[model samples]
Target chain A: MNAQAADKTVATMAQTRPLVAMDHVSKIFSNGTLALQDMSLTVRGGEFLSLLGPSGCGKSTALRIIAGLGGVSSGSIDWPSSRINSKGLPEGDISFVFQEPTLMPWQTVFGNVFLPLRLRGVSKKAAEEPIMEALTAVGLGDFAKAYPRELSGGMKMRVSIARAMVTKPRLLLMDEPFAALDEITRQKLNDDVLNLWRRTGITVIFVTHSVFESAYLSNRIVVMKARPGRVHADFPLVTASERDALYRSSEDYRQACEKVSAMLLEAMGDAPEGH
Target chain B: MTSSVPEMNASSERRKDIALRIAVPLVMVVGLVLIWHFGVVMSGVPPYILPSPGAVLSALIGDWSLLFPALVVTTKITLMSLALALIGGAGFAIFLVQSRWIEIAFYPIAVILQVTPIVAISPLILIYAPTTQVALLICAFLVAFFPILSNMVQGLKSVDHNLLNLFDLYGASRWQTLIYLKIPAAQPYFMTGLRIGGGLALIAAVVAEFAAGSAGASSGLAFRLLESQFRMNIPRLFAALLMLSALGVTIFAATSFISWLALHRWHESNLKREN
Candidate 1:
């Protein structure tokens, strides 16, 4: 993790094509509410991106659209650097984490983590290593036999994260996954997510309303607006090579948070007069 | 080391709590039996009118040879109907959840069947069915079917939207989603249905037997009760009534145990609370 190697990685990342592109996507509910309006965004490979906005900003809508869980009303989504399945969606290359830890109540931690692989026709015997690897990644290796009810809120969320990552998807979409957790658990999960993103080099599109969270974890932030939800501003927020407790207290991180807060205020139409 | 004393005290307290749970019910049953025997003795009512507890017990032993076969027959009918209801109810629920149109088309018919009293319709079933056993089974099946169907339908429909989106993101096929996500998600509701349906099936079977009034060796306990009443064998009637109640309790306890076994690990409803 020297400067020269980091510089080389950045150079190559910039040169590579975007993994997915949302071009003029609009989402209108049948009841006449427009969730997203002509929204356009590009997700480059190996980037930690955050969709930061207040409620009704369609950040979650955008994430769902990208994940193919939702359809755009008028525009198209394209994957330039990832493989597509027969249904024109990405083939086992996307995972999503929800605000709630939505584990199967009937399944153990190991079984829950092994779900994606099992759905792909892998036998339980074949999934053992990868399942354990995922549990170990989330530091839940010993609790594989435990049920979700046996875990605390934070531990359940960890199991959720392990399930999401077990498939080794190229893109991970999280919609306020830590919103329900306490402050300490939230911070711990935030660091774990950032570390996982860096170690795996996967593209992350996290949806959140917290300015501090967006600023701390994301290399790039897309600030969105409500009403007819659309991107108000998109900017880079790279503050340091390594983000940890040290980075959180650094002057650079404070400045980054302030900058993102200003953009969020502007997006919410509450920014003060310009300097 | 100092904490060991409190831990031991807590364990002993828990043991005492368990003992109380078991002892209280036993005391209640024994006390009630004693009261019943004394009440019969003191009142000096004829055995045909009010059998003593001892008389009932002697009748149970005396009639075991005749009544055991009838018990087996009734048990068979109850269990068979319950099994059929489970398979049919869950299968129909899965079908209905596949599309709104199917549910809309058929749910009303199911509602009508459920709302109409089984006793009111038992005569028609007896006329239509090829055999007395089939008629009894149909009655029991009808009684047991609705709870399972409704609960399972609600459970299948209650799957978390985010988990559905995750499955879509993983490119899971419809069959895979049904097996891996929907079925597991609906299990708690299905178990609830099983408990309700199990009790209902037994009741319906006995009712159907009474309605049929069949009196051959193949007849169930309901027929024996009728025969005992006609012959003024009050103690034997009480014995049959006691056997029926025992069977009902056994079915209830078995279903509850099964539900606990399935859901104690993960489901909130079945999980043990420390406090």
Candidate 2:
């Protein structure tokens, strides 16, 4: 009876497929540049997935396509029946955190954070709590009244993240969101983003060039290659959901980083030693 | 001691900078007036041809009642025309950003208005309008509108692409994106347009008054200047010229203050860099 119960659990786990799937998608810009050709990806619901590759790999293009900001020239992206998927939900529930802070320089932190909800026609009074909550989540609660120019580069990035989170999105797309920040600030933000994802049970698809960052933050990494960009490889890290400073400093994390670096080099067609 | 030395150097440098900015201008003005006063006195140049500084000052004080009313008329015309141009320019700019085709269609017309000298257009306005004051206002409006329109359009277009994509992905409506994102982003450019437009409005007001030709004492300072010239009242002509110059300076100062108020908290153009 115990064996049969375990079998049943495996069947149910198999039934819970990826929330989103892109089937051989292609994107060709008007300038005749093929940014992506026959790229396929699957994003599992409530997982932290990172797309890691070289500069021309179209990882950002793929993320933008997933966000519906860019159009695919061919093939399709499908979503299963997960609640976090795009099925029967308005696109407003999806959020994107861009590379640069991209904060409205004219607005204070509270105003920037308040934007998404305000765009949805939520009254200022109704959005005040959520805005403040998001700011607090990013440790920018004290900066609500500060303008973007008053904030440091890291603080600006925090405000941008706060703005994205204010709407409580189901799927969060981050495209090298912390690439410009210093190492310390980047690590802190990485920790904060993971906590946010875990606490909210939100799905994330992050795009970055850093192998170490991908290994450290994501459960799965999707590696891509240039010259008509397409998915090159996929690797899963440890199955554990929790990661801490001890985990980051462990042999397991180092191995994962090494594996990702190997995958990246291989994806680049075994390019000669220089980064 | 090291920190204090740098701080002391900075304060002293700032004081020297202030002295240069103020004292240089003051000395030049005093020296130029002294030269003009002595040149006229020593050369025995007739007051009817080139009034002495003493003559100009006395003329300004004695004819204060006449000049003051004319100054008020000129200022009113300039300010009213500026108000009209701002409203019209901003409204047109908002319309233009609604579509690329709209911008292409109407932008050249605005450019043509800008390039065609107001001096050439003033006569047509004088002939068409019911009164000289209305004609002057119209001429000023034509002069002021294009800078505001062109700058606002450029500002709207210069919005960060990623920010725009974020707005789009979040399902922000066209109206919401325009009001929250585009308008605020366009502010720096709008401020630039205002500065240019302020000076142009004053010039147009004066030029239009010249074109209006003997439209009476209430026709503005330019008309008073012309009347004084015809009557060989050189001192009064100098006084009118001084009032006109003062008006231009005042308009520029007011526009700059407005720009500072609007942007000092956030914009790079106004904010003082720490380093």
Candidate 3:
């Protein structure tokens, strides 16, 4: 099966409950630019969702709001309280991966990955196994002692991913984490991320500009429009497998990509093909 | 991109660095000795006006009895003053970072101290303080204080926003942020300030000695220089000058090496590898 069929499956699954719920979220900058406007979304548990849009469409803004890094001007977010209630309010339980790797230059790969745990007063000796596991998950076990300056762009991003995952966060918010890498690296990282997600069963809210990337990775794609950014389309990929070359190359995946691309183009005030 | 060319270039670069580092000072030393010897031989200049390098060297060795004690006294003053300056400067910097109101209130005072002539202030300090050593310490502390405060303030303020946000997301307390993030972020700047302040402290101690005009009770290098001038002991004066120069160079080199070592492992300022 392909993205469309997988999305149908997820949609049916989401009918029961949502892991994250946003109600009428709006954001206006001090300079009066509206980054988001009355947007609402519900991310189901264990779902891989992508906020897809053109440049300046506020997909990132939306993600930041969900992560509580940016505040909503006029709406409420009702994230599932179950995870927090059990763990004393999961204060640092959510992790964010920025477009830039944003690794601390003064830390080794292992040190960066261990930061969240260290901040929680976990000893280096205690966190060693978990840090190693996270690094191994990101294929950076060999680079544990390496600093950010020693890593390639893709490798730095892998370190960033490892840092986020080391805490085993229930909700991971990624803002175009692979946008800075080349196509090959991006594709490879996309696969690695899907594998990690499948293995961990963690929820992901990723923001990206590429419709094809959204179709390839996300169980649900939230297509956003600019100029008071709001959700223009919400398309879910309905695939059985986490990722497969055959599913990516299938006719259904191509149609979903085309549909989202067309929706994005229209959002940017461009005429669709054969208009 | 040829391996041979890059390898050759690396070796040649190393060779050039070694040559320049050794050759520049060696040539200067040789030339200065030759100039001094010839000037004494050619000009019927009195021994007091222009002492030969040999005579200065002889005086330095022969008068070791008097000069060694003076050297020790000067070194103690320099070290003590610098220690005081470091403590005071760092204390003020921490205060400045704690409140904008404190910064506004005290930054101008620091600038005023930096701008005021040390030579001019030394006399006033000598008169007001209870003892000559105390007066000298105050003078040195005043001269060395500003750079540490200014550089540290800038470093503390220049912490990466993402890192700050990361700490906040992890629910790190204010004290944790200061100790873990702010202080480490400020290391380069603090070291820079300390390096500069180290040199300034020596100058201030010398200047204070000159202003105090005390004949004994912890008289430093400056007092010896003055005594040499008053008694027409030009060779001994040159010996004292040599000691001062050596002291200055030692302080600078020691501080620079410390800065290098502090940053060599992790910071980009001294990173040895490139991606």
Instruction: Note the DockQ of each predicted structure.
Output: 0.61, 0.58, 0.47
On the 0 to 100 scale, the lDDT of residue B11 in model 3 is: 86
Reference-based TM-score of each model: 0.94, 0.90, 0.91
User: lDDT per residue, candidate 1, B105-224, as tens digits?
Assistant: 999999999999998999999999999999999999999999999999999999998688767777778999999899988999999999999999999999999999877888999999
Model 1 residue-pair collision total: 0
lDDT tens digits by residue: candidate 3, B167-265: 776767788888878888899998999899999989988888888887874678899999999998999999999989999999998989999988887
Which candidate order results from sorting by lDDT in descending order?
A: 1, 2, 3
Please give the ranking of all candidate structures by DockQ, highest first, separated by commas. Answer: 1, 2, 3
Best by lDDT: 1
The lDDT per prediction is 0.90, 0.85, 0.84
Candidate that scores best on TM-score? 1
Q: On a 0 to 1 TM-score scale, where does candidate 2 land against the true structure? A: 0.90
Chain A in model 2: its TM-score?
A: 0.89
Q: Model 1 off-target regions past 4 Å?
A: A1-7, A270-275, B1-15
Q: Identify the superior model by lDDT, candidate 2 or candidate 3.
A: 2
Q: Which stretches of candidate 3 lie over 4 Å from their true place?
A: A1-17, A82-90, A240-242, A245-248, A270-275, B1-16, B271-275
Flag regions of model 2 displaced more than 4 Å: A1-18, A81-89, A239-242, A270-275, B1-24
Q: How accurately is candidate 1 docked according to DockQ?
A: 0.61
